[model samples]
Each structure stands twice: as structure tokens, then as C-alpha cells.
Target: MTSIVGYARVSTRDQNPAAQEAELRAAGAHRVFIDHGESSRVVDRPQWLACMDYLRGGDTLVIRGLDRIAGSEVMAIEIVAELGRRGIDLRSLTEPAFDTTTPMGRALFSINAVSAQLRVDTIRETTRRGLDYARSQGRIGGRPTVMTPDRVEAAERMRAENHSYAHIARVLGVGASSVRRALGAASSR
Candidate 1:
């Protein structure tokens, strides 16, 4: 038999999920799984995993809101698509258009998924452009290298003296890999 299963998540232990659980129950959910102190971004949330395991084909997964299930539009689309693939339906107590049991709802979901994908693509493109601009400005991102020019010079002298990279790194208080890379870069120059 098909069942209506609900999942709810709260980011902090101080937050209560009773209100969401109550709403899911009112919406005909036979069982509600709640994850306290779990962020919606975490797909491995204990209660959410349990809920997914408990659900069967033809089961309807209900949520008070999409935010209870996903942290981003991409995540929401992925979860909805997975449900569709598993022959499970999704319903949002607050978002009526998200009910996948109806043709209109399914159409709306597809539109929303497309919009979400566009937003993700736009963000990715914008970030790439920003990084390219930064590169043009000679500004590098990520952690600064610990190997200084002086260290490189010293490492070279040590290497000339037949010292191992590990020994040079120990003297310079840096990783052997960093010492090797600094020497390698200096040699290439």
C-alpha cells in the first residue's frame, strides 16, 4: 500500500520541529521523520536517511516546505528528480504547485527545475568571469605559499651540498613537498 511519509529538518537543536511535524500530520502523513540539529544541505542527515529507507515505490514524500528538504534550488531539483525516478511522489504542504501527483504540478516542477538549472549555470559563469578578471589583475586566489625566495635559495645551497629534500624541509620548517616544488620551480626558471 502507498503511504504518505514526511521529513523535517532543523539546523539547530534549539529549534523545534513540532510545528512542521504537526503540519505534515495534518496533511495525511502516516509517519514523520525529523532531524534536529541537521542542516538541509546535508544529504546524510540521520532521520532523512531513515525516511528515505522507509519509503517504498508509490509512497508520497511530504514536507512542510522545500527548505525542509533542500538548501538550494539545485538540491531541490535533484531530490525531486530522484523521487520521480523511484516512482515516489512529492508534496509540499505550503507549496501546492509542488504536488507531483497532478499533471499541472508536474509541469510546474519541470519549469522550476529548469529555472534552478539556469540560476546555477549563471552563477557558475559569473564566478568563472570573476576569477578570470582576478587572474588578469595578477591576483592569485587560495592559500599563500610558505616557500619564500630566501628559502628557495637556501634550499638550492643545501641541495648543492647533497642534502635530501626532507632534510632541507626540516631545516626550513616546511613540508618536503613544498621544498621540492620550490626547487623545481627555481630550476625551471
Candidate 2:
């Protein structure tokens, strides 16, 4: 008798997993593992890893969708391939055609895999173009700076008066790391 296991995850606690759980139960899953507040990008999720450990060659693993297993298409395909190599069956409730346990299912899975790969490639290309454009425009991509030259000068004066980094940051309404960086930049010049 092969066991059927279901895995469900939501990236935030505010989201409900009730629908996914109901679907898994309706599909006759013997056990269901739920992970809340876990990002789909993270592969080290406790429940997900535990589910993999509990599965055997004859067992089946079910998920709400490919995105539920992994945030990225590459990651989803890799995980699905790993399961196939282990002789474990994968069933997506949302994409019932991707069983991978039957010939037709395998073909369908192949199509989905190719589609996922294309999507990832397109996203990567778009991101590269966007970053290149931003770089050419001389726009910084990360968080905006919170300190100005005046703030740095005031922080330097405070530091020269033997004030602690924390005190200087508090007085200037900035962070200690900001004060330190400002001082470092000043000294380097």
C-alpha cells in the first residue's frame, strides 16, 4: 500500500491554507504537512524537507501547484526531476495533467517544464536589460541614503568631541552604521 502525502505552504501567515488542505484531503492524501510564513524561494523549509524524507519510491507527493513547491520555475523543475529520479510520483492539484506517473502525464510534464524554462529565461533577460538601463542612467539600485554631507559633518564633529557612534547617530536621526560609513568616507578623502 503506497502512502499519499500532501504539502501546502503559504508565504505569509495572513494567508489561509484551508483551500489547499481541503483539496489534499479530497484527493485521499494519507498525511498533509503545512508550512506557514515560509518563502517559496527557500528550499530548507522544515515541513517541505520533512515531507521529502517521509516519501518512498512508491509514495506520491501532492502540491497545490508548481509555485507552491518553489517560487522559481528552475527550482520547481529541479525538484520535480529529483522526485522522478527517486521513482516517486508527483501530482499537482492545480495541474492534474502533470502526474509524471503515466506516459501521457510525462509528456505533459515535459511541455510544462519547457514553458517554465522559457518564462525564467525571459524574466532573466528583462531583468538584465532593466539593470543595464538603470546603470547607464547613473541611478543607484539599492536603498536610498539617509544621510547628507551636513549630517556627516555634524557626525564627524560629534565623534571628534569623543561622542559614541550610537550617540552621534541618535543626535543626527540616522543609524550608527551610517555615522561610521560617513566618517570612513570622510577619512578616506
Candidate 3:
């Protein structure tokens, strides 16, 4: 007995997944699972995981679109490949030609997979180049320090005078954590 499991997702709470669910039901879905306020980038969605668990060999998993199942084309390809390996077919209502059971569909999916891989590779290369350039220019990217040198010196003086962290913080008009961080930074240097 083959089952058709439909999965619908919306990235935000304001977005409604009713239309996708309706389409999936109209397309002959045996069961439909909806996940609202869930990003496709997250693989641990409860409804999505339930749909995956409900699928068996020769079952079909339906989605409104590739983006409904995955945030990126790479993730989409990986998910579709995993379904194929599990002997489950993946069908996109919006992309009728993306069926993995057909040769032309497989070719189209392969093209998308190759494009996604190329895009990921390009992004990795660009990030490496940008980081290398920043390193050569002696520029490090991170959050700026909240405490200034003058505040640090004052905190150190207070600490040397037997003032507790909370006391130093009260004198410096900052949080105790800030005083501790200042002391730690001074010690590290």
C-alpha cells in the first residue's frame, strides 16, 4: 500500500500554509503535515520529521515547491537524493517536471544540483579571499570592546586596593561582568 504524504511549510508566523495544504490534498495526498513559523533551513521540524517517518518504500512525498522543503537548492537536492535512496519519490506541485522517476526530470534536477554546488564553491572562495584580504590589512572582524582603557585601568587600581568585582563595578558604574572582563583582559595582556 503506497502512501502520499504532503509537507507544507511557512517561514514566518504571518504567512499562511493553507493554500499549499489545500493543493496537496487536491493532488491526492493521503496525509498532510503543516509546519508554520518554521524555516526550511531547519531540518528538525516536527511535522516534516513526522512526514519523513510516515513514508515507506514506494511512497510519495509532495511539497508545494522545492523551497517549501529546503531553504537552498543544495539542501533540496540532498533531500531529494535521500528520498530516492530510501525508495521514496519526491514530487513538487509547482515543479511538475521535477519528478525523479523520469529521465528529463532527473536531468533537470542534476542541473540544479550542479548549479547549487557551483554557487556554494564560489561563496566559499569569495569568503576565503575576503578573510585573507582583511588579515593582510591587519583588520579582524568581531564585536567591539565595551570597556575602554581608562575604565580598565580604574578597575585594576580598585582591584589592587582590595575592592571586590561588584564594588569595582559600582565605582565604575558598569556591570560586575564588565569589571570581571576588564580584569581578565588586563591579566591576559
lDDT of each: 0.93, 0.89, 0.88
lDDT string, candidate 2, 25-123, tens digits? 888787999999999999999999999999989888988888888888799889989998888999988887878768888898889899989998999
Clashes of 2: 0
Q: Lowest lDDT 10-mer window, candidate 3?
A: 96-105
TM-score of 2: 0.73
Tens digits of lDDT, candidate 3, 125-170: 9999999999899998776766789999988998999999999888
Query: Model 2, 76: alpha-carbon shift in Å?
Result: 2.8
* Local accuracy of candidate 1 as per-residue lDDT tens digits, 70-124: 9999999999998999999999988999999999999999999999899999999
Residue 71, model 2, lDDT: 82
Cα RMSD (angstroms) for every candidate in the order listed:
3.4, 3.4, 3.4
Better of 1 and 2 by TM-score: 1
Question: What's each prediction's clash count?
Answer: 0, 0, 0
The weakest ten consecutive residues by lDDT in model 1 span 140-149
Best by lDDT: 1
lDDT of 3 at 39: 86
